[model samples]
Target chain A: MMSDKEPLFSAKNRKLLTNPLGSDNPITIQVLGICSALAVTAKLEPAIVMSISVMAVLALANVIVSLLRNTIPSRIRIIVQLVIVAALVILVDQILKAFAYDVSKQLSVFVGLIITNCIIMGRLEAFALGNKPWPAFLDGIGNAAGYGIILVIVAFFRELLGSGTLYGFKVIPQAFYDMGYQNNGLMILPPMALITVGIIIWVQRSRNKSLIES
Target chain B: MNTQSNTYTFLYAAIMVVIVAAVLSFTSLTLKDRQNMNKEIEKKQNILKAVNVTSTPANAVELFDKYIVEAIIVNSEGEVKSNDKAETFKVDLKHENKKDLSKRKLPVFVFNDTKVGKKLIIPVRGKGMWGPIWGFISMESDRKTIYGATFDHKGETPGLGAEISKPEFQKPFTGKQIFDESGVFTSLKLVKGTASNNPHAFDAVSGGTVTSKGLEAMLQDNLSSYEKFLKSSK
Candidate 1:
């Protein structure tokens, strides 16, 4: 369905998917959005929820911006994007408060902070403004998923080591605590999320030599 | 030519404004009912918590209906003045720039629990790590011993200050005295050390020092306003 205007799922489009995964990845390559990456990764549940929320906002914003790309005055394009992003964020915030009040409460300012996430803005400016809606949407989702992958991994380790649980479920037996298994309290802190992401980048780069260059 | 240019700019700006406004209005109208329902459910959930009636979101409304018998709004002096429970609960401490001494109406929800009998749940709002923090503080029929508490914050750091909302942190407040035997307002406290052996003191959240302090300050500030009402009720 995408090839009529240019080439259906062309090599360019294929690069869009793979790029965010490694070479041109927003988190690993550009090192954007490290703030939320660290804050929400202390547990898998919040991390996953945050990732989905970001993805929803990113994908929707990309499509909306792409549709309006033609008429968006150059001088006001950034303002327009901000307005759209803010609207979406507010809508999402209201929905969360209404539906998932607890999680929404837990998320708090981070939901409002979605407007500041560079990845969403980056995709709007770098990819969405120039591409068709489908490609822009795909790029947004792909990058969001990449970000989610990093977050889930970090949260997995953090929750396991910090709280000795998975998604708040106790995993390590009481025997481990009885045997003197000390929960790494540091893993629950924000800085640990950063270190976890950094380590993942290092491992990912080592495994795939090409990603190292980026 | 000048007229043409003026006309075009006017039309363009007008169209843009209308389009944006319409889009926002449509979105708002589309989601308004669901959003309102969600907020109502949330309030019900908080009210339920104050009375120790724990339930998930799906059942909050049902549980609230089954347990909550009365909701009344009391002014700072604790006089029953309004029938609107929700509006009284909407007091925004952040928006109201008045000093802490300013009098305001506080929403008090009366829940009749099968196990715990009648309890008064008061809504309290105050400052926290990032912005406003608020919660429901339920008092037993004596209106002294705290029954259960639930707190939420705007932007406090998760796993740290944000833990204030977690059950592990708030559960400590349960059974703590909000007033002394003389009926003097002792104010249930979030203390530094392990909540002194006093019934009025509650343990501070371990990692969330600032948030814990915030919770303490919030309780003191809001509950003090309702002292007159509390005293009159006694």
Candidate 2:
């Protein structure tokens, strides 16, 4: 619907960029990417790294898909999308392997799993297929950010309570241990991550009634 | 755009495949060196860990070179084979373990420890529940008692089997004897539940019996090759 005379960032495109952050959050609202959310959030560093990797892949994949949208055959669109996403994921995985070896090891196969992350494919199919490159790029970044925000938040609480640390730094004072404060060991487990995500969804839905389904 | 034509579809897929292959291979080829260097550093760190010496990735290479005085590739016959040709660091267990025991090049790293003096570190690998479980066992100069040991797994379940890398799991191996009182090579066993006050058998990780047993089997399998060498040395 954007015209040549309109402002570069119109209200419509701004909504596309901002809606995913809160009201249309991917992890909290759309409930996509819950697998990686529960898997890597035991520690904040890995979770943060995973989020960035996913963001890079998602953003780049969306742009590539959108740019090729015109040429992509109707019969082969899904395969085209998979090929693009896989290539981008491999590139990200290789770069991470070269630059951040430890974090790469911590993230492990999850970086490759970004190819299968429904959020990336969802955005490309729902938004990128129909939108222009710029709008698609913004949508990609917005949705990825929404997913990354939830990952970081979940990791924050998990790392804080499970290991009494944040990003590997001991945040809870040792004196607290002397006062019988025990880090919840259960929080380090996968179930606790699901519970944390559930709590976020609950709180979010409670505040925003529109997100609740009949 | 004749999108549904078979000719166009085949051409498109072929072109796409070629493009993806070229870009992926190019990326992998360029980053291979740095990735390998990181792996080497990690291996050095783990080897150092077996001797109670620790170093970060930044300083692992320097520390490794300073402490590890010799890298010998010994065969099953207890003979130290071609020193320069073998290139001990290049010995990969995943490959060597597949070869016949007699043909395998068993690399041993001699660590010059400050307190324990000279220590021999032998690397071993075996199958865990999920994937490969590997470790370094630091043997005292006598080659009988374990100075220290370190275990690492490829894809073991966290908090359960992955605890093999924890200090508590590795510490109990420090004073355990690899040989019995009569000089019988017993290696070590990861017994379930209570350890029965035996020096050769250690209690396995409670929830990680498979990985613990895998480590025990790896130690036995790899260490058996050193039996002739250990006996000859004495």
Candidate 3:
């Protein structure tokens, strides 16, 4: 093992932060956390809020799991990870209710459902258990950011086409509507979110040849 | 230190549960008041919307006190049970809906405004396809014609059933009548197809058949329960 003298932002540690932002993205590449991606992407505001919420839960859960790695019984590890996740999710949900009531109302049960988000569980089991707390923290942030990027991109197009607005503002001009332009109704539905994510995956694979299998 | 032992696993789980339970309890207890205040503000805000008075979160409580001149609780027999603000505001329709008709504590808010005139507002609750749906419905002094209405849902399908909460759906309900020309209560109807020229009917949401039907039943059932009160007031 490398000495503790290794610089904090060493190349390996940097890769842990950067890899998930692109080639190893949690949403597009690993295909985790697509349920929330589809549910909240109808509006840009909710998508951004959800992304931040997931990121907070994931990073904290990672650090906690890493710290408890040695003492956690191997037989009950999954349950242990679940309890940490569920607790963090409830904390986030309560905070949102007290402070950001409107956004929390919009998110509804999806906030609580974060307990089931596979991305957090996958990281806790695969990465956090074997790594130091700092690297595990970085991995959590990177993966969640990767997921957020795809969510924001999908929300951008959906809100624009479906509602003809960005973040609830009128982006399309009145003149365009006068010329008989109508917002695409299909874009507002859940199926369109799946299709949008599929399109992103296609474009990403085409750009990065190394991602494709023979 | 044997991680694979059954005894260790049980002990680990037991300790983990205690810690998690304590943390969750502390959070819930600390934030309970603020969370409830937020909810109360939202309820007041929605009640204002039903009467066509817009209000922000910061001003909801003040405006509610201003516009809602009297918060009265009434029974099925059209008799006023209590006019206390705390008692009236605390009337939960979900719980009342589960009780017998004669024992239900129905809340009725009297909204007074110089520009909008006086109106009677009532709350309704029902089951949607996915979960519970509820809303406030306002009526003109005649107790028959709807003035303005607002609806909200727990977990309806976002694009389809959840459309009930939108302004467009609630707008059409403004001028509808709950009672016919003869004064017999014939609660509003939600027509599956076009409503045509019917004064007692409106079109249901297109793709949300179950939710639409549920909302229709909610309106009919709740409005009919107030029949005695409507006739007595008139």
Candidate 4:
């Protein structure tokens, strides 16, 4: 029996888990999931839902792809990945429509748009295609968390400043509005999401010099 | 056996497709009942919303049964037919909207408004900027003036066309006359800029011209089915 071999959360696996949340961030650094980040971040509720949906889909797809890695033909692997992602996305959409009608209403077609999110395919092609099932699952969760972190951060600022609310709660007091405080309407617009992402990237790079490129 | 052979690739793709298809269908079928229940509750909520009722999904059914007094189907001749609440509540607006006005069976919900007394709510369906838009408009006892309205859309652009569902956009519809003094059905107008000094007009949503226009048309077309009922009932 292997004595005290590499732990499940091995140093390398831990790096796989943590790296995506920082220097190799999916949204800030890799810019893989910017479209949904911009679209769903207008409201915190949808952002959280989208984040959770992506996390679930990504982790499941990764495990499935990793299991089929050997038998997958290189030429048709992309299609196979797409099929897996699309199926998972539809299932998620159905569940949301059943249980989260209001949220699903706001999300509308964006739930279906999850199929187009680059991060799922990117992870499947880059990591899952060549990795073991366990490592692939970790990579999926890590990358999705990286994307979700940015989504939540962007949504936090957007909903608070743009709507004067957090997750539809009136956190910004009515007194502020009565005293001539104004919500920045631009924050709710899609361009502001891009700008917010850029600002996050800026702050992160400045803090960690290793993240900056020459 | 050549691992890279086309036969192997074809088999792999075939098997994958079959598995994905089976799983997706199973999920969809299992969830169909729950999804339909959600839709029914939301429909109740929207109808209730048109009459200034606030309800969550948990309480929507109870509130709907308590508030909605009767559901009736009316034809283009404005003749009220069957009053089966269950059957009428389940009528598909899209399917009915496609039929010729003369043959279409329009479903109307009679809501006993605590504030305004009795109001009849007619559901309207139309196109929006990006997708389908629909809502319920409750007319006062006179059946000529709007008591309240609620609009919802599938995929209208937020902050623009989607503003139709907002309180500010819908508030103006109240007390607005849908018909002229001479009893001519002019249908309410959606003034683009402002609706000041207009007894029969409401302000169209800014930056949501298509959705606004769609709502206007939807109200006019759908309401015409109740013309005779309104005239006779009055």
Candidate 5:
């Protein structure tokens, strides 16, 4: 139990919020939810929308699961977590369709596919089940931000090089295309997403030598 | 309570399911109207797109009302069944496509714009590489050559098959004739390659062969029924 005297953003709690942004990153270090990374990163806009959706799902799922951690029957914890995540995803998808219709259309089935994203399950089983609601929420935000940052980075390069556009706006000058500059078609394909993630992993591991396995 | 007991697990599962179901159903019920409205607006926008009229979600309804001078539902025999705009617009093409062509309620929208002129817009539905693909194809006043087209897919591969929805693919459909010089219904074809010189076909997306073929078949199947209507209108 968190004591009344304990500050809300205590040092330990801060690490829960910050660690996943770098050294303990979910996508690069843990590599949990790579399916969506490959699926939605073709364009920058969908990637950003997807990142926000996943963050919302993850943070809420973490808090809910954490609040019920003790009362949850250990024998059926996984099922409970799945139910919560699925419910939240459906809610998000409905809300998106009602309000952000265009983005919802761009996302389409992938929002429903969020129920299958492993990071939410992994966080619930690992951190939320063991930690208090506050730390669980922080961890959720941290890991989701980690995933979002990488998605944004990959989408940035993909949209810029593949489509010569960012968020559907033409960023590369027409003069370049007039001068025979061609967008890299390969970068637009799904295979290129894996390669981009691979490069990010390689660069991160090389810089943080401790991340390398013995 | 023994949380680990089988009874406890069963109760927990049952209660969780009840809560989740309630939440989901409530959400769906509350948002159904707004979601349906969005879909209706998107359909109107797509219909307008077939005539090369650009519209945002905010202005789609107004533009649709302004540009669509008539919505006519016709049968396979080229006989008009209804001309009520709302009734024709609400005709669900996905369901209509499933019926025999003779029994289908095929909707035709006459878009009247001072600059773009009056064009006939028809809806087409077919399978894509991943899922259902549908689009609107607008024909010029000649009732032969396509004026504009707009295609959308449920789940085609992002940069490949899904390119059918992009302008680069749809733009080439303009000026493509669905009838031969003899006035026979040929339907438009998505040629596999090198279709620049072909007036009846457009180049298919390079990496989207299956989707291209599916779209081609869709045009053939959907447009053949409208042959009588097109000819009679002309």
Candidate 6:
């Protein structure tokens, strides 16, 4: 029930979604969600799935927390956020088990660990607590999408070079193997994920001059 | 308004605890049936994997009903125990761990098949590269040939040691004999080379050295206990 003076869907509110992708991206600008970016980016399929799951959780959690901001006491705001996040994570885990058992098994503890992912907590505290629900939800989605874009790119190269495959399908021809072209096994390791992400940031920064400082 | 007593603090804490407990209890009760069903389905799925049958959770029960004919509880000596009060499937491995080895209830699943009329499925669990590895080994009616096998691990590296769970890795176990003609026990071993001409040995993964060894150890340790039962049943 926003007043006419404060429009529900203003230009500034719309900017919340697009701004995070370029100028004020959570990954490049704030440097959040880097841990997951480095862990699950070994394979394109897992990285994509992880990114979507994170986005859904963050956006929904932000909207819910923003809606309940008034009821949360200042002294116990953090506790309330944690409780809500934990409950939501459990629900998500249950849904995954019921619907997508194999993928859920593959994800295992990572889904449960979403509660500890700092980005969700940071967004809730820094933006959702003060902003209206719509804007906060948009911000959450925008930041998640930005993070997802970087992860997918990193996973693409890693999976291609490391396993010579994409989305679990053999992409590199059999001739490549017969010609003694072996997979770069190092690319499948966690350290390679870090180096790949670092290279992505380097390329992105070099191309986009403004992102250099951030 | 004055700072008189701490009654407010105590009351608030008490109310919060009661609310939380009630919520937890309600949630647990509501999901209890579904959780149990999921567990049953998961168990059936694992059993089917043991017999080289692949099926999703949705069709696990159907496949299990089609393949699994009977289940029995046997002692370490391989004798059928009249523990009618306790179902073989309901035997908890964790509870069996603390008890004396001789007293543990071992579940033996019998599968019905045209090729192998009745096969014995034994469950095995032990330490692996990262965490516990478990599997079910189904022996053919002759008690020598392996009907099928399945293995699973927790936290093992994917595409490496974790490949043990894949059918490509497990397929070698089928038709491999577990005992010599002299009734001498020669359990399957994860060999370094190709599967030996001798029926008792199976080839191990080259790169997954530790996990292969772990599988070998797990098979020997868990399956050895069933030898007495196996011998008597024969």
RMSD from true fold, candidate 2: 2.6
Error of 4 at A93 (Å): 1.2
Candidate 2 Cα outliers beyond 4 Å, as residue runs = A1-8, A174-181, B113-115, B192-198
Give the C-alpha lDDT of model 3.
Answer: 0.91
Q: What is the DockQ of candidate 5?
A: 0.88
Q: Please, what are the lDDT tens digits per residue for candidate 4 over residues B64-99?
A: 999999999878787777899998998898999898
Task: State the fnat of model 3.
Answer: 0.92
Candidate order by decreasing lDDT: 5, 3, 4, 2, 6, 1
Which residue pairs clash in candidate 2? Answer: none
**lDDT by residue (tens digit), candidate 6, B1-234:** 312236643454456447656765676667667767787788889998887778898899988878887888888888887544228777776576456779877888888889747788988877777887788899987776788899888766666788888888888888887677898777887777768575788777767788888888878777777888887755
Error of 5 at B172 (Å): 0.6
lDDT of 5 by residue, A21-68 (tens): 899999999999999899889899888988888999999999999999
In angstroms, how far off is A129's CA in candidate 4? Answer: 0.7
Query: In angstroms, how far off is A81's CA in candidate 1?
Result: 2.9
True contacts kept of each: 0.32, 0.68, 0.92, 0.73, 1.00, 0.00
Each candidate: chain B TM-score: 0.80, 0.92, 0.96, 0.94, 0.97, 0.80
* Cα-lDDT of candidate 1: 0.79
| Quality of candidate 4 docking, DockQ | 0.73
Per-residue alpha-carbon lDDT of model 2 for A1-214, expressed as tens digits? 5556657688988987799989999998888888888988998887888788887888888888889888777788889899999999888878988998887777665777788889988898888888788888889888988998999999999999999999889999999999999999999989999999999999999999988999
* lDDT values for all models: 0.79, 0.88, 0.91, 0.89, 0.91, 0.79
RMSD of 4: 2.0
The 10 consecutive residues of candidate 2 chain A with the worst lDDT sum are A1-10
TM-score rank order = 3, 5, 4, 2, 6, 1
Candidate 2 CAPRI category = medium
Higher DockQ: candidate 2 or 4?
4
